[model samples]
Target: MFFVDTIELAGLGNRSYLAGGAHTAVAVDPPRDLDQVIAAAVRRGVRISHVVETHIHNDYVSGGLELARVTGAAYLVPAAADVSFERIAVHDGDRVEVDAGLALRAIATPGHTPHHTSYALEEAGAAVAVFTGGSLLLGSVGRPDLVEPRLTERLARAQHTSAHRLAEELPDETAVLPTHGFGSFCSSGQAEGDHTTIGKEKAGNPALVREVDTFVAELLAGLEDVPAYYAHMGPANAVGPARIDLTPPAVADADAIAARLAAGEWVVDLRGRVAFAEGHVAGSFNFEAEGKVATYLAWLIPWGKPVTLLAESPDQLAAAQRELVRVGIDRPAAAAVGGPASWVRDGETPVSFPRATFTDLAKHLGDDVVVLDVRRDSERAGRHIAGSVHIPIHQLHKRLDDVPAGEVWVHCASGMRAAIAASLLDAAGRAVVAIDDPFAAAVEAGLTAVPR
Candidate 1:
C-alpha cells in the first residue's frame, strides 16, 4: 500500500508532500524548516530515500537540499534548472525506485518555469499519484510571469500544452497533487476544492478547457502585483539556500530595543492586532503572530535591514521565528518576550491608536478625516469609499508622504492589514484609527460606492 502525507505551509499558501510505500518515501518541495518533515517521517516509520523539486521555487526557500543532506538521500532537481549545487539531474522518462515495489517517473511539465517537472508515483507498475509542482493546479496553473518578462507569453502557452499533456496521458483515476494554488500568489487564479483527480481537472480547470490564446489572454489580464520579496527568493534558491538557524535570538533589554530603533532597525511586535492597537513601543511595527507574518513582513521590510522582535511570550517569538526563516529572514537581530511595558524604557509610555469599525467611519465620513484604503489595487477595483486615498500596504512604507494630511481612518479586506498600516501611520506621528472590522461590514453599513 502507498501512503501520502501533506505538509501545508499555510502562511505562504503552499503544500509539500511525502509519499512512498511502507518502508521508504520521497519528499516533494519541502519548506526550509525540516523539523516538521522529519517528524512526519518518524510518525510514518518510513525512511526518506529521495528529495525532489519540481523547479527552482520563487516563493520560499526549499528544504530539499538540507533534508537530503540530513537523511543521506539523493537530492533530485530538474536537469534543465540552472542551479549551482550538485544534484541528481532528473530528466523526462527518468525513474527512481522509492521502495520495494514503488517508484517515481519524471514528466517534463515546463510552464511554471523552463525546467519544471512533475513526478508520478507508480506502485507495482501502476501510477497511483502525480506530484504536479506548479504546472497543473486544482483549478488553474501557476503564473508564468515570475520569470523573465520576455518569456511570459511563451510560458503561458506552454502551460496550456502541459496541462493538456497530463490530462491526455495520465489515467483519469491518477491523483493530481500540486505544490501551488492552495492560496499562494503563484497561482494564476483562485484554486477550488481540497483535492482533485485528472478526471476532475479535465472537466473544470481553465487551462484544460479554454483554448491556448484565450487562456493566456485572460491569465495575463488578471495578474496582480507580485510581492516585493519574491524578487529575492528565486535567486536565493538558484544559488542553494544555506541551512537555517532557529535558536532563540539574543534577548533585547529595553535599552537595546531603544538603541536598535534609534539606529533605524525595525522593532516588530508579534502580538494580536487588538493588543497591539491598545499599546506598543513607539516606532515599532506590528505584524501579529496570529496572522500571515512571513508573507507580509518579508514583503514590506527593506531587504537586508536589521530586525528585532517583540512577542508576548517565548512560544510566540519561537513560532514567528520559524515562519520568517522559511522566507529567508534567517535570524532576527534580537527578540523580547513580554508586552509593551517591558519593551519600553523607564518612565516612557507606550504608544497607542484607536480601534473602530466602518460604522464609526461612517459618522466621520464628511469631516476632516482622511479615509485611507490600504488594500491592493485589484481589491479596491471591486469597491471602495468614493474619495479615499489608495496605497497598497506593501508600498505604504515608501510612500508615507503620499497620504493626505488629516486624522487617517485606515482599512483593508480584514482588520489585520489595517492594523499594520495603522502602526505605520502612528509611528509617523499621524493620528490614525484602525478599522478593526470586516470589509463586508462596510457594505452592510452602506459606506462603499459602486464597483469600478
Candidate 2:
C-alpha cells in the first residue's frame, strides 16, 4: 500500500505532502521547503514527475519552480489562473499521469481563485485520492478573495458552487489531502491544529454545510484581511520562471553589504517592521514578513541586481534565500554575514530608536507635543486619539507643510513606519519625535477634542 508523508511547516503552520513514490513522486503545494521536497523524492528513489500548486498560493512563496528545477518535472497551473510561467496549464477533466494506473486528474475548482483546481488520483479511472489545494482545506474552504475582493455576492456564488461540486462529484473513501493546514491564513475554520478528512469536512466545514446563499454570505463575512502586497503578486505568478531550488547564496559581511547598498543595490531588512523601525541599516527598504514576501520584494525592489539581506540569524539566511528564489530574485551582491554585530562593530552608523514606554510617552505629551497620526484613513477612523492630525504615511513627503510644525510627534499603530517617516522628516529639518503610543501621549497632554 502506498502511503503519504505529511510534513507540517511548523513555523508557517501550513502542510505539504510527498505522496505515492518509489519510481515516481508528486509534490503537492510545496510549502516553502524546496530542499525537503527534493530530499523526499531522492530518498524514495523517485523522479518528481510533477510539481502541483493547489492554487496560486498566498501564505508563502510557491516552490513549484524549485521542485521542477531539481527533478526535471512538469510544473502545472490551472488554465484560467492569471499566471505567466512556463507551466503545463490544465483545465477540467485533464490528466497528468505519474505512472501506470496512477494518474492525477485536474478538476477545475474555481472559487478560492478563478483558476483554482483540485486533483483526483485514480487507479484505472476509479478515484482513490484527492489533493484539495486551497479549495478545500482539512476542515475549511479556501477564501475566495485572492482574485475577487471583499467576498462579494459573485464570490459567494462561486464558492458555494465549487463546494457543491466537490461534495457531489467526489467519492467518500477517496483519501483527502489538503494544501493548507490549521494555521494557514487560507482557512479561519480549520479543525483545531489538525487536518480534516474530506468525508469529515463535508460533515462539518461551515462553508460546505450551509445552503448556496448562506454559504457565500458566511464565507464573505468571516474572512480576515489578506495582506496588501498580494494584490500585485497573484498576477505576476501566472507567468512561470526557471525552477527555484533554494541552494543558499554566497554570504558577505556587513561592510560588503553596505557597499552594495551604496552602489544602488536594494537592501531588504528581513526583520519585523517594529525591529527595523527601532533600528536598521540606514537607507535600506523595510520588507517585513508575511504572505507575498518574495512577490513584493520582486515587485518593489529591482531584480537581476544584487540584494543583500539584514537577517535575524544564521538560520534565517536560508529562509531569506528561499524568499528571494520564490519570485526569482536569487543573486545577492552581498549581505550581513555575522548578523548585526559586525555592522555595529564597524561603526557604519546605526539607526537609533528612541521608542518610549507608555509612561515615557505620557511624559512627552505634557511638553507641548503635536500628535501626527500617519496611518490609513480606516486605521485613523477606527480608534485614534482625539486632536491628532491625520497625515497618512505615504503622503507625509508632500504634506509636511500641512502638519502642525512645533515639536511634532509622529505615530502609526506600531512605531516603525512612523519612525521611517519621522527620519525622513527630520532630514528635511523638522523637529519630530516618533511616538509609539499616540493615544496615551495625546491623553497625557490634556489635549481636548470631542467626538464628531
Candidate 3:
C-alpha cells in the first residue's frame, strides 16, 4: 500500500511531501517548520523512516535535519551538497529500501541547483512517483540562476536537459511532484496546476517542447530578480539551520514597542490593509498577515535586526510567525496581539492613511501628485499607467529618497503591493495615497495605459 500526500505551503508557493509504503514513509523538501510533516505522519499511522532533500533549497530553509533528528529517520541529502553535518550522502543511481515493499532511487537532475537531484519512489518494481523538486515543474522547468552568476546560463541548459531526461526515463503514469516553482519566485515561470504527471510535463512543458538552445535563451531572458534573502538561504542550509522555535515571542507593551521604535527596530503590523490604513501605531508597517509576509518581509527586513510582530489576534500572530520561520526568520524579538485602541489607551496616538481607488487618483492626475508604480518589471512591461514612476516594490525600501518630493500616489497591479508600499512610505513619513483597486478597473477608469 503506497501513499503520497502533499503539504502545501501557500505563502511560499511551495509543497513538501510524504510518500512511502503503508508502514514507513519518507519526507521530502520540508520547510523549516516540521510539525506539519509530523502531523501527516501521525495521521497516516506510519513512521517517517527517511528525510530526503532534492537539493539544498534557496527559497526556504530545509527542515530535513531537524525532522530526521526528531523522527530518528536517516537524513539522506545529495552527495554534492557541501554541508558540515553527518548523514547518508546519496548519489545518482543510489537506492534505499525504506521497508519490505518500498524503495527510492536518486536521479541526478541538476538544474535548479548545481547538485540538485530528483527521487523515484518504487513500489515493488514499479515506479510509483518521482519527486521532481525544482527540476521539472507542471508547466515549466526550474530556473537555474539561483546559484552564482557565472553558472546561470550553464545551469539553464542543464535544466532543459534534465526535464527531457526525466520525461524520457519515467513512465507517463508516474506522478510528478515538485517542491518549488509552482508560483514561487524560485522558478523562471509559474506552473499551471498543483500536481502533474511525467507524461503531462513531457507533452506540455515549454522546456521539453522547445529546442535546447532556444529554451536556454528564453529561460535566461525570462529570469526576474531573485529575492534579496536568497543569498542567506544556501549558507544557512549548508551550515545546518537552527531548530525552529515556535514559542510565542515575549509580549511587548506600548512603552516597550515605542522604545524599540526609537531604537530603529522593525515593528510589523500584520492586519488587514483597510484596517491598517484606517489607523495603526505611528511607526509600524502593515504587511497584512494573509499575504506573502514570508517573501516580502524577509526581503525587506534588515538582516539580524530586532523585529516586533503586531497583529489583531493570537491566531494572526501565530500564522505570521509560521510564515516568517519558513524563510529562516525565527523568534521575533517581541510580539503583541491587539488593535489600535489598545495602543491608544497607553497614551499613544495612531495615524491613518487614505486608500483611494484608481478612479480617484485619475481625478488628481494633473495635480501635484506623482503616480508611483511599484509592480514588477515584467508586470509593468505589459501595461502600466502613463507618466508613472517605476520602482518595483522589493527595491522601494532602499530607494526611498528617490521618490519625488510631493504628495505621491502609489499602486501595483492590485491593491496588495500598493498597501505594502503605502505602509513603507508612511513609515518613512512620506505623504502617500494608496490606490486600492484592480488594474482592469483602472484601465476602464480612463487611466492612460502605455507599454514599456
Best by TM-score: 1
Model 1: per-residue lDDT, tens digit, 1-452?
A: 88999999988889999997889999999999999899999999999999999999999989998899999999999999998999999999999999989999999998899999999999998888899999999999999999999999999999999999999888989999999998788988877789999999999999999999999999889888888889999999989999999999999999999999999999999999999999999999999988889999999999999999999999999999999998999999999998899988999989899999999999998888999999988789998988999999999999999999999999999999999999999999999999999999999999998873
lDDT winner among the candidates?
Answer: 1
Q: Candidates ranked by TM-score, best first? A: 1, 3, 2
Off by over 4 Å in 3: 344-347, 448-452
Full-model lDDT, candidate 2? 0.66
- List per-prediction Cα lDDT, in the order shown: 0.93, 0.66, 0.89
State the lDDT of candidate 3 residue by residue for 199-267, as single tens digits.
Answer: 888787888999999889888888889999999999999999998888899999888888889999999
1 or 2, greater by lDDT: 1
Task: Give per-model TM-scores.
Answer: 0.98, 0.68, 0.98
**Candidate 2: tens digits of C-alpha lDDT, residues 135-254:** 776766777776656545665577667766777887766777777656555654544645445577688776678787777767676666554445544544555434555555666666
Clashing pairs in 1: none
